[model samples]
Structures are given as structure tokens and as C-alpha cells.
Target: MEDNHIHSISSKSACKVTDDICLPDTNWPRLVIVGGGFAGLALVEKLKNKKVQVVLFDKNNFHQFQPLLYQVATSALEPDSIVFPFRKQFNGYKNVVFRLAVVEEIQPTSNIVRTNKGDVHYDYLVLATGTTTNFFGMDTVADNSLGMKDIRDSLNIRHMMLQNLEQAAITCDDEERDTLTNFVIVGGGPAGVEMAGALAEFCKYILPKDYPEYPSTIMNIYLIEARGELLSSMSDKASSKTLKYLEDLNVNVLLNESVSNYDGSKVITNRDNIIMAKNLIWTAGVKGQFPKGIDKKYVVRGNRIKTNPFLMVEDYKNIFAIGDIAAVITEKTPKGHPQVAQTAIQQGKYLGTSILNIIKNKPIKPFEYHDKGSLATVGKRKAVADLGKFRFGGYFAWLLWSIVHLMSISGFRNRLMVGFNWAVSYFTYEKSNRLIIRNFNKPSESKSTINSQPAVKKITIND
Candidate 1:
């Protein structure tokens, strides 16, 4: 059976001199959505069977489950378990088309989006480009440290970690071996905490058994945070418990200290500590990421676009911004809602309904975010959760966290695979997917190789 649902426009044809690649005529409004993250997917799901011809654009063809990316980095789960292809996800949506292209700029005056492939006109445009790793203007850190933003980054971390271990096993120099084994993670956010815990678990269970050549005691895992507490957004109880959990797992928690600089080998902090480590996983912060054409006035702190109560971008009714890239300021959320999956998902669903209301000439409702609580797991059975005033930390919280994340995953197959992996790891204490499929180099070495590639083309659907 031929798969006519998704098609790719070849690079040669995409680069042809044409005014605009012709699109199928439709009486309904054509909606162009930029991104395939949590918010964009939710919006597309809501617009299913609606009076709209939706075209979704993303550089990648898959929607990544970001919350569980750490597991991939630590080899706890394979990459396939956390990523779902867009074509498979929207196979039944006949009115929707998925394009794999890099959006260069937006021409708001003409309602056309200029991409690497070609120009695409739309009746309404939605920007859910999400956020990128923010280095806070620290060039040294940006150049030297590894980030956990995407699956590629996770795989790079995994490869670097295993490669470093392999090198440590062969090196005779004690200092070099120590640097190879030393792991420093900046930012005590959920990603950093989970990574630290996972690394510690590896040292405890897997390292001793798998790599007997190198002693596990020599390996050092450090969690650094500028703030005094971990999981600052959560309640104090949750924060304290999380700190305790990390300490119990033998992770060195550095509080109230900021990374001053990293020269690719040494991690220099504001305090007296200057640690040597080749691998530094940075999860400190993230800022809004979108293409050009949005006015500077509309962009606020953290590089986010200012959106109204209806999630429409300021000064443009037909353009909307949601997810981590949007700053929807309200009295309750003066600084905008926390950049979490729930916020994006809620806003996306609301914006979809609002678009339909606008089409029907009916009143549109404002978006209201209901806090669904927060959860963070440190080690196997050590976790913390904050639900309103109720706070809990222990094995129950870990189980609850696992169940919630498993249910939140995209497909049943992914959930089952992840559940099975967790069960196996629980009993056997092993991470089977540690193979380095591709070798990873430092950012400076890899940047030139990536820049040589041509622009991505679109994935077209048959009429």
C-alpha cells in the first residue's frame, strides 16, 4: 500500500523560481501553525474536522515528549519511546497537512510565511515555536556546555557520557580520568534533578556492574543551582524533600552558587569551588524562540511575545501565540504563567475553540489556566509532589508521578514500552539501550558540519 497521506517536496523543485507553491483550493480558512510541540498538537487536535484547512510546519517530523527526555539522556529509555511521528499522529485528519521545513521569516503585511521551501499564505497564523536553551549571555557556557533541549541533545549527552567512561577506563592519568568521570549539571530544575538522580543511579547500580574497570567511587555527580532551594516553584516542603533525596542519592548539591565560567575542562563558580569536568549538562533556563517579523514592542522579557487574554498576539488579531513562546499576562499571573506543558496544552485547546468562535461570529472566551500541581522524582522511590496546599514526598509520590507521566505519553505503545523498561530496570537494575549509535563531538567541532547542510523541504500530501 502506498502512503499518499504524507509527501515530501524535493529540494530541487522546492528551490524553483515560483511565486508560491500552489495549494489546493478550499472555501474554509487556511490555518498555518508553526511548530509541533505540546501546544501546536493540542490546537491541531481541537481543530479536527473543523472548518479549516490546517498546515503544520516543523523542522522535525516528530513531536517529542519533552518531560521524559532525561530518561533518554541517561539511557533509561530509548529515543523511540518518547517521540511520535507527525504523519502517524494525524493520519485520519484529511484536512491537515504536515510540512518539514525551517520557517525563516513571517511577512505579516501579506499574510504569507516565507520559509526555506517557499512562501505559504494563510488566513490565520499560530506561533508555538517553543523555547530554546538560554545561556544568559554567557558565551563560554554556551560554547562548552551540553543542553537537554531535544532528542539529539539527549543522544549527544548519552554518547558523550559513555564515551567519557570508556576513555576513563583506558586512561592512566588520574586527573584526566577524574575529569572524564566528573559530571556537573547546572540548574536544579526538573530536568537537572532528574538527570542528577539518574546519573547517580547509574553509578550505584549500572556502573559497578557494567564497568568494573573504573571504580564507581571515583565518579562525582554535582547539581548546581544559583538559587538556595531546588524546585523553587513548588512548596517549601517539596523543595526540602527533593534536596534531601538528592543528598541521599549521593549527589553533591551546590546551592546559592552560580557558574561563573567553563573553559571546556574546568567549571568555575562564584564561590571558592573550581571543579574540573569535561561534561557539563546545562538546564538553567530557556527563552522564547520564533522567526522574524514580530515587532520588538510585542516581545517582552524572556523573549516571549505578548498575547492578549484570547491568546492573540498583540496588534494582530489573526496571529496567535501560545506555549512557552507566549506571555499572557493576567492579574493572577503578573509574570505570565509558568512555562510548562500544562500551560501550553490549555492555551492551545482554548485558542482552537476561540478560532472556531471567531469563525462563527460568536463570543470568544478568555483562557484560564487551572494548576494541575507539580511532581519531581529524585531517585527510584524518592519523589515529591505539591498539590495546592497538600504536599507529599516518598514512594507514593514516585508511583503517582510515574502513572501521570505514563498516561500523558502520546501513544499506548510508547506507554507500554516505557512501563516495561521501568519494570525491567527496577528488577535487574540495568539500562540496555546504552549503545552509541553515533559519535558525539564538542559543539565547536560539530557546528561547522551542521552549517553545511541545505535547508529542509516540505512534506506534501496528495490531493
Candidate 2:
């Protein structure tokens, strides 16, 4: 068969024409990772000073310590404390390059990735692209509510919260003021529960003294959820303990109900009840983030990439998936493992060693995740931790949670700064850096981002 004959055969076989997926200059092993979050960073760190060329891309230039982002938004921590520059993370490593670009898709057929900046190629591709907020296809919820995902999102929420208070101070109508004062946070997950607590703390210990004009009781922080209880992933004891803690702190906990709609000023629930509010915080749900080029059937529960226990997408060699995007399909985990930082970290470490072994023609070790535990803190002296069989709550739980999170930061400098912020916030009961700077897109940004892309051009990777 001639070259043209093979070309005709290939083109005829598929509906969409893919010319080729091979890299042009494939001299050295080039590894291009799609995310700068937990799993991607872990792989880069583990492979630092190794024998390969590494390139990392993300929309943001900083590696955020997400667990503490709620604190930043609620004025308990500074933005810089929770965010570490991505360049600084790999300063000593000579084999790594970082790019601030939005990944449009991975063209696995062409062995290229299409992005906003341009295309990129790799000998090996890693998909660590993390999850994003899931509104369950609700348009009003998507249109009116504010989400707590990245630093920018958190900052926006803070601005809206404080702005509402300032607005309420001048308004004469009690009903209107009450509407502005109600802060409704959707979801019972860690982010939602933690935000509700921090907001309550602000209302109780800080807001009263700061805003003498407004009554302290005027601040209504509601935590709404669709489940029967908060922290459904944790033990019964932890959930019950957390509920009591939130209630004690004046957090209005609503369970087994959901946000039906938000008309920019009031929240409509499934129970036909409406709560008037100026600010709505969405920490409700998340879905697995998969780039293009893979078969849609591979995307399973939570939109995760269907993968084997070895962390490889089924039937694909040289390409691997990790972090929140990759779902390790197993009988035990029919859907997938819980999407968490620890799970991503362990997978990255395992994959790092496995890749090295494969290079040396050694036996490959399959990746297995170990469930350490989970914790969510609700303001000062109120927290919960579940460590396998053991469970604890209250001040000690808060202490443990703080220590673990601080230590988990990639660099010591970040850990130190975060630790300092925590100490100051503990004593002062005030978040120092509360500047409302930029006005982010009000959930409508997604529409603009999706529309801005080119009409499916062949993306190339310039090595």
C-alpha cells in the first residue's frame, strides 16, 4: 500500500478527519502536564532533577492552598498567605517550565493540545485538571449566585458580603435591609459548612464592633444542603457534632433541601419557601474536568475519566490521567474514589515511580489510595476530624486541622506565612486584608469563555 492509499484508508475510517497524532521532533521524552494543582504539582516535584523535559500549564500562575481559601474570602486570612507563586514552587528545578494558559482540549489523535495561547505537544501527557462547581444544570442558580472556587471567586464573595452590609447601613426600609443582610451558602460540604461558620464568626465577634450602626443579630448566615446531614462523607458522630457547633455559632443549618432558584435578591428552595438575600455562595457540587480528544464513554460518574487501577485510561498507552479528572474504575469503587487532595497526591507519587520503573524495563507497580482521614473546621474552637476509626471535634480538631493544612503546603515559606496569618486571626478576630478590588464576572464568565475559542483548529505543541 502506498502513502496516499494509507491516508485515504485513515480518512475514510473516521467521521472526523485526524491527520496524525505523532510528534515531529521526538528526541527526548517530553512530559506536558495540564494542571498545576495537587496531583500535577506532586508529579513535577517528585520528578524534579530527573531525566526529562517538563512543561506545566494552568490558567493561574499561583498554586493555591484550597483548604484555607474559605478563610481568605471570609477575611480570616490574606490572599498571599493562601496562594504561592507557581514559579517559586519549581525555582530550584532545572527541567521544568510553567505557562499561564487555559487548556482548551487535548488532541490525543494528533498528540497535541489546543490552548488559548497556542498548541503544545508532548511525548507523555498527564491530565490532572481538577474539578469545577456543578449547578446541576440550573440556569437561575448559575445566573444569580456567586461561587467559591478560586481566589478570584472568594475575593468577589467577600466584596459582595461587605458591600451588602455597607448598603444596609444607609437603607431605611427594614425588609430591604433584612434581605441584604441574609447570606445564603449552598451545599453541606466542607467549603459550605466552613464558610457558614466563618461568616457567623464575623457576625458575632467582629461585625458588631466594626459596624456599630447595624445590629449583630441582623447577619443571617444560612447553610443549605440537599442531603440529610452535613459532612455526609464523615462518620455520624462528626456530622452530629458539627451541626451542634454550627447552630451554637448562630449558623442556620438547613438539610434535605436545595436551592431551586435565585433571582439575584432572594433564594427559592425546593420546599416552596423563599429566603431574601443579596449574596448567595455556591459550594454545592463539583464535576470531573476532562479535556477533549478522549472518548466520551470514558467519562463516567461526576464526569471523571474512566481509568483502570494503574491510573491509565483504558486501552491507552503512554497517556495517563490523574487527580480529580481520573476515575480509578474498580469493583470496590464502581463510580470512583473520593475526589480529594490526598488521593491526587498519592496517585502522582505512585505514577512517578511507575513511570521511572517502566523506563528501566522494571516491573510496574499499580497505584492504590490510602484513606488517611478528612476534616472541616467551623470557625475558632469549632471543628471536626475523622481518622479512619477515630473521630474528634471541637477545639482540638481545629488545632489538628490547622497544623495538618499548614504543613501540607508545598513550600515552607507558604506554610510560615499561612501559619502567621492564622495566629493573628486567632487573637485579633479580624482579617486584615479586606480590600474589594476587581469585580469578577457574575457566573456569566463561563459563557464568554466558551464563546471566545476558535472554531476547532488543529492545535499543535511547540517544543
Candidate 3:
């Protein structure tokens, strides 16, 4: 069959609706993907030269390498090195069309998707919207702490840390200086562990050179976890080794503790323990983020859309879900697959073939996820890996982590830039340019700091 005969719509006419997004005229089956994360991009790659007209919608014009977001947050790498433009990625793929728009609603009955920019109809819809920082309804913590989910969030952290360190040097009061230099990181996951380690290294190496007035010991690093162990998702051996590595780097690891509130300067834990610090990083949890319109019953825990084994949304044949936003509910896998890059990538590839097969009226198999192991780095020359039966940590694991991440980045230029930066940092222990280009103030500090640079709060710690 010819491409024009695949759909009922004519190939010569454009979208006629007044609020419709302008798209190329095509009679091929329209595969509209709502996100450009790992899953969406993988699916796009699979259908590159195919007859399907792939339309990708995302809020940002670029796809972020989320695994290396911590490096960006800690100044080990520049933001651009880890984020690739969507247009650049779709250079050779003629069938793919990239659109920068936030999907507002999904009208399944009308086969249309409403967005902030305009609406676009889809023959087959896929939701790969991914996850967002989950504050767990703690408004105070959400307002004060920064979550390392996006590139902008990473930059905000860098600016906040640099600005605070500079303020610490200018303050004459001893108590205020301590609060400014102290860092509190909530969560013991990979992001939290890596962030704590990076901050500790910054305090150990950069603090002395940048600000010689204060001792490096003045900058304290803390990693707090609600659970008793770090990397609870990984092996016990990996967890113990990660904790040890952080401690060796002078990071105060606080286990079985959870943050209750944060009023910008003080971090109050559920156990009534208070830590006076101006900087707080939250890496605790994430919930799926997607547009409204789906039935409430289809939504499950973690705010994910419940889907069948074929990666299709329940009771909907044309609509599908993938990546972190999808919860493939089955008897064997109750909650769904792990919300990671590997799972997303695999699902995208599988669904790509399945969708094409469905279009051809062929048999489609169930989506199966193969566990590809996991790796988490603590600091330079320190990492833990759980590769099936082979569980290891330290130098070799760190090397494997480095290679895997370097090769996983989107563009060749980005990979080269990151590899070069890593090599330089490895030899000299020096980070990228630490410049504060923007003024990022927490919600509590925003009003007071408006019209002023950084409102250096001089609050005395209560004993």
C-alpha cells in the first residue's frame, strides 16, 4: 500500500482547524509523541525513514542527558554539554517533526491533542512525558529546596552554591558564615550521593583556593536519607560501599532521617534535628508529569498512566504510554518496570516495531523489559555497580560508569566536550568555569532579595 492510502486524510491539504498547529501535509499514519526524553527519541530513531509521520512535542527544544545532570549541577560540566537540541537531533530524519509546545490536554475521543501553542491530531499517540520532582505535598520544602531534574535546575544550584560561598567570605559574623557555607542534601539516591560527593570535593579543593580567609572545614556537607541504607534499590554491598565512599570524602551521611520543613535557612528534620544551612538540594522522589484528560481510574501510584502489556493504555487501542509516565500493570510486575533510561529506551524500540506491525495488520507481541544493571558514582575514582551477578565498586566501576555515560550522550560534540572536561578534571581536580550569571533566589528569599543582589540573611542559630 502507498503512504497516502494509510490514513483517511488527504495528503495535499493542511490542517484546517483555526487553533491547529501547522504541520506538513501527509497521508501517512501520524505518530504523535508527547515528549522527547529517552523513550520518545528512541522511538523516533526507529521510525526515521518509515512511512509514519512522527510529530514530537516538548516544552524545551533540547533533550537532556539526565544521568549527567548532577555533573552540571555540581559544575563538573557545562549545561550545553549534556543537553542536545531537538532540531539538531532530527537533522537527517525527514519523517520526524519537532515542535516546542507544552501539551495541555489529550482529547482521545476526537483524536486530537491540545497544546499551549496549538492543537494537533494524532492517529497513534504516545505519552513519554517523564517525571517531575515530588515534594510529597511539603510546600515549604518544595519552595526552598532546588530539585535537580532539568538543566535550568542544575544551573540554579550552581549559582546558588557559588553565590552562597561568596557571601560566606564577606560575612564577618562567625555563625552567619557557617550557615552560608554549610550544605544539606536530602535523599541518598544516586543524585543525592553524587551531589554530596561533588560538594565535598568542592569544599576540599576549591574552597581553599577561591576563599583563603576561611578554612575548608568550615564548609560542611550532609547527605540525609529517609531509609536506613543508601542505594536501597541496589545490592547491599553496593549500598555499604557507597556510604563508605561518601564518608571518606568527608560527607556527613545521616541515615533513617527525613526532612520535615525548610524555612530557607534552617533544615528541620522529622526527628526534630535542625541543620542551619542556606543551601538545600532535594533528590528524594519524582512523580509522573502529563497532561489532563485521561480517566482518573487509569492513573496509578506515582501518578503514572496504567497500561497493558502491549504498552497501550487500558481500554484504548490507538493511545499508548511509555517512559517514566507509563505503568505497565501485570500480574508478574505489579508496580511497573523501573523508571530508568534502559527501560524507557527498550520500551520505545519495542513499541516502534509494535506500532508498525499494528499498522500493517500483523501480530504484535507483549513488551518485555530486560534488566541491564545499574551504576552510581559517589566521587572521582569512586562508584558502585550492580551488573546482574557481578556487583562491584571503586576504580573499575567508576571507569565503566564514565565510559557508559560518555557514550550515552546525544551528540558527538557533546560527548567530546564532556570527555575532554572529565579528562581535565581527572588530572587537575579542577571544574568548569564557575561563574554566577543569574540571580537564583528561593521563594522565601525572592521578595527580600528583589532589587538587591543576594540578601545575606544574618540569623543566629538557636542552641
Candidate 4:
């Protein structure tokens, strides 16, 4: 086994090996994993020290802790606190290698992955590409609204939020100011609810102190959901509790309402209520994001690749699909498992062992998802949890949520930073990382204007 190395595959080295861009030749079977999310990471962990050459490919160099992305968007935690470098993570794994590349296509017949850099041959391939925000064919909404799917998206939301606040403070037009301050979030899922709560907290605590000129009361937070209840996947008790929690936080929970369209400055709902909001965060839905080359028949609803019981893609034995991109249709889970981190983690670990079993000519076990629980935090000291027969909410659940998330985070430094931030916010209501490093302009705005705009100077808030 050789020490793990991180490489950037070059386009010139597509089919053949070159000095600058080449994977070490080995007799061991090469396992190529596409993605650096929960599943891919878990799979790598399981494959550590195994009789396999593992190569993980991802566009980004870091594995983002997606569960806490809302915290980053709401300025509760910095981006670095939720992201871990791939190289640092797999440092001791001698059999593994990490590559920074965007996978362009999957050639299953040839057992090769075509990336932007080059094409790499593989003995077995794992598709854990994860999910991307689904705009549901609404081009206008997709163009205008911000989606919180990754660190960049979260940072965009934060920048837009602070920029909107600054604009609201300077704008003479009352309607424009209202539009700037009104935060509209589509989808009542955990992300939307958490965002609404965080924004509500910002209105209740941070705004009055930071921007005294603009009344905090003017900053309205709306959480719109087409469904009747929030946390629709959770138990009714959890959903009801989450609704109450959001309401208590002064987050306007607009149930049974769908967004018809979002023009840059206004949100038109199906219920005929027009919301003036410059910042619209869409957490409505997600669809599996996979590269081309797979048969369209294997791609099912939600853009997920259909897989058999062993987590193998339909009609393929060596290629497997896991995480949000995989729809492992079973008798019990006909629609596939919930697109959550746990499902991906478990599936990745299970498939890793299954692959080992295949290599050893042993019986491969079927993948089974263990439902640990579902949890969502609404506001400070307010959350709901559904743990099978046990259902609870409020302060205890909030504490549990915090601890679990803190522990689940990637690194020790990240855990410390996030915990410290949470403590600071809990003890004294303040968001320290609210500095707008980048001036975020509307998507329709000219790129030149965006580039020419001066960066926001740092402001020290006096106690």
C-alpha cells in the first residue's frame, strides 16, 4: 500500500499515464467514487486499509457538512467551521487518493469516468453524486431565488442578506426598504424552518442593535409551504410542534400556499397574496444530480438512479449508486429512503462491505436503512425530535440537536468553533460573522456593476 496523494488530473493524460498526471499502477482493483458528500466519505472510511485502490473525485476539495449549511447562511457559523478538506481527512489512508475534478460522464460499459480533467479507468464505480436544488422547471424562480445546497450558496445568501440590509438602510423609498427587509423562504422543510427561525432571531436580537436606524419590526420573515404542515416527513406531533416553534419565534408560517413565481423583487403565491421580498431562499426540493452515460430507464422519479437490493444500479453489477442520487427501491420503501445524511452514510458503509464481499467471493448482504430518528431545530432552545416510539420537543430536543450536530461535524476545530459560536449566541444574542465580505447583487444585475461595486468595510459593534 502506498501513501494517499491528492492530485489534479490533467486533460492531456486522458487515456494514458503521464509523469505530471498519473495514478500509480497496481494490481489491486481500482474503486472510483464520485462525490465527497456523506456517502462518499463514509465509503472511503470503510475502504481504508482494504485491498483496493480508492480514488475519490469531487469538484470541491472539501466535504461540506450540509446539515449545518443553514447556520452558515444565517451567519450562525462560518463556512470553514462546516467544511473539512479532503486531503486532511484521508491523510492516513494509504490505499486512498483524492482528486479535484468535475465528473462529466460515466462510461459504465468501459468502466471509466470521464472528468473535466481526463478519463480514468476503474474496476468498480460508485455514484454518490448527491442532490441539487430542484426548481421544478420554474426558470424565473430558479434564476431569482437563492438555494442553500452548498457552502457557496450559503455564503451567497449571507452576502445578499447583509447587502439587502445595507440597501434598506439607505433607500428612501419605503416600499423598496420593505422589499429589502422582507425575507421569504419557500418550502417548510427543516432547512426553511431553520432559516426562518434564524432570520427571526436576527430580527429580534441582532438588527435592533446592529442597525438601529432600521426598525427590527420592519424585518418580516415568512415561511411558505405548499403542504399543510411543516416537517411533513416527521410525525404529526413533530410537525405541529415545529409549526408552534416557528410561530413563537414570530416567523410567519404560511401553510397550504405555493409560490407561483418570483420576480426579482416580489414573490407571487398561488393564494393571490403577493409578498414583497428581495431575498427569497428556496429550500423547497432536491433532485439527484448524476452525470450522463447511464441508461434513462435506470433514472427514475426525482432524477434518482434506480438500484437493486444490493445497492447496485439496475442492469449493472460492478457499478453502485448510493446517497441522495440512489433510489434503492425495496418492498417496504417503494419510493426509496428519505434523502437524508444518515441514509447516505449507512448505505455507503453497507456498500463498502458488500463490495469487499464480492471481491472475496462471499455472499453479499442487502442494504437496509436504519431509521435512527428525525430532528429539526426551530429557534434557540426550541426543536422537535421523532425517535421511533419516542417523540419530544422543546429545550431538551434543542440541546440534543445541538450536541448531535456538533459531534457529527467533520473536524475537531470545526466542532470547537461551532460549539463556541452556539454558546456565544445562547449566552448573548449576537452573530459575529455577519460581515459581508462580498457585495451580492441581484442575479439579473450586470456582472461589471457587481465587480465595480466597492466592498463593504468592516464595522466594529460596540457593546
Best by lDDT: 3
lDDT digits (tens) for residues 1-463 of candidate 4: 2233223222232323421236755556789999999999999999997888788999999999998898898898899999999999998787888999999988877777888888888879999999999999988788888999999999999999999999999999988888888888999999998889889998899999989997788888889999998999999999998888788877788899888777777676776666778899999999999899999999999999999999999899899999999998888989999999999999989989998878767898788889999999988999999998999999999999999989999889989999999999999988899989988767892222222323433111110
Expressed as tens digits, the lDDT of each residue in 291-341 for candidate 3 is 998999999999999999999999999999999999998988899999999
Candidate models: Cα lDDT each: 0.86, 0.79, 0.89, 0.86
Clashes of each: 1, 5, 0, 0
User: What's each prediction's TM-score?
Assistant: 0.91, 0.88, 0.94, 0.92
Better of 1 and 3 by lDDT: 3
Candidate RMSDs in order: 9.8, 10.8, 4.4, 7.1
Query: Candidate 2 local accuracy as lDDT?
Result: 0.79
Per-residue lDDT of 434 in model 3: 86
> Where does model 1 exceed 4 Å of error?
1-19, 444-463
User: For model 1, how does the per-residue alpha-carbon lDDT over 1-463 read when each residue is reduced to its tens digit?
Assistant: 1233224322232222322655555556778999999999999999986767788999999999999989999999999999999999998786777888988899899888988988888879999999999999888788988889999999999999999998999999988998888899999989899999999999898899878986787788989999999999899998899998898888889899888777777777777467778889999999999999999999999999999988999899799999999999888777899999999999889999998878767898889999999999997888899988889999999999999999989888999999999999878878999898988887662232322334433111110
lDDT of 2 by residue, 143-228 (tens): 87877878877788888887778789989998888888888899998999999999998889887787899778888888898999
Off by over 4 Å in 3: 1-13, 16-19, 445-463
